[model samples]
Target: MNIIGGIFGIIFGYVLIRYRERIGGMLGDPAWAASIGGIYNVLIIVGIFIFLWSLTTMTGTSDFLFSPIINLFGGNTPPAPSDF
Candidate 1:
């Protein structure tokens, strides 16, 4: 399941990077077009992040990259038992 999800994520990220201009134009948002770096640039950055994350996940190395973030949000803590 993780491998499948990672593959799809990589493809999705590639699509976002490759067709960012078309996707942004289809959305037809003026703000998207008028941004400082442009919507395509934003999409490219997001796509790169997604691509790297998916690649790491596929290789089972995502833990190294994301452990700090997970720990920051307390994701590694065990759940408390119910009082009832």
Candidate 2:
């Protein structure tokens, strides 16, 4: 759980730092970049669900433990990207 949260945080932070300009422009506030960072993590979780739903292979415990737990309760509430 901690590892997953850490990875999510790193990815979110990276997005905010890398695209601060364009994201800031779209949302009319520089802080929106930071906001969108959280959204990116949510999208990753949702995408993982969709991908897993389409497959039959057994997922490793590590993968399931991290992303699933984060999406279910570890991360932010009212998930960003407005898709939680």
Candidate 3:
């Protein structure tokens, strides 16, 4: 399941980066067209992030990448049992 989701993310990210102009036009936003540089840069960054993240996840190494952050926040502790 993780692999499937990662594959989809990679494809979506590639499409986003590859056809950003078409996507902006499809949104029908004049502001986007006028100030495309900023938006384009943002899209590129997001797309690249998604692609790399998916790649890591697909390889089952995302935990290595995220474990430090997770530990900083207290790690992956399970919820406490309810008293009921």
Candidate 4:
């Protein structure tokens, strides 16, 4: 599967490079480029926010996503104090 995928990728890349000028002329527009860039920036900012939020609100022993217990098993919420 990997070999087939690699061969296909090489062929696809070759075709893309061969027709890069034509493809660029067809696809390139200042307004389109600007819109795509704006969207990409927005997604990046949103991703950063999500990462920070996950870090902050995490209840497990480890602050970051992956740690010994957390990675091996799953999120371990801290146990409540015994009233007895």
TM-scores of all predicted structures:
0.77, 0.34, 0.71, 0.34
What is the C-alpha lDDT profile of model 2 across 1-84, one tens digit per residue? Answer: 555554565556556656655655565534443565654444455445534432322333545556766777766356458555
Collision count of model 4? 0
Off by over 4 Å in 3: 26-37, 77-84
**lDDT string, candidate 1, 1-84, tens digits:** 889999999999999999998997886656755565777777889899999998998999999889999999999999999999
- Once fitted onto the true fold, the runs of candidate 1 whose alpha carbons sit more than 4 angstroms away are 29-36, 81-84
Which of 2 and 3 is the better model by TM-score?
3
Global lDDT of each candidate: 0.88, 0.51, 0.85, 0.51
Clashing pairs in 2: none
For model 3, residues 1-84, the per-residue Cα lDDT tens digits are 999999999999999999988876676545654565566666788899999999999999999999988988987888899999
* lDDT assessment of candidate 2: 0.51
Kindly state the number of residue pairs that clash in model 3.
Answer: 0
The pairs that clash in candidate 3 are: none
Candidate 1: residue 29 lDDT (0-100): 55
Best by lDDT: 1
**Model 1 vs truth, CA RMSD:** 2.3
Task: Give the clashing residue pairs of candidate 1, or none.
Answer: none
> Which one wins on TM-score?
1
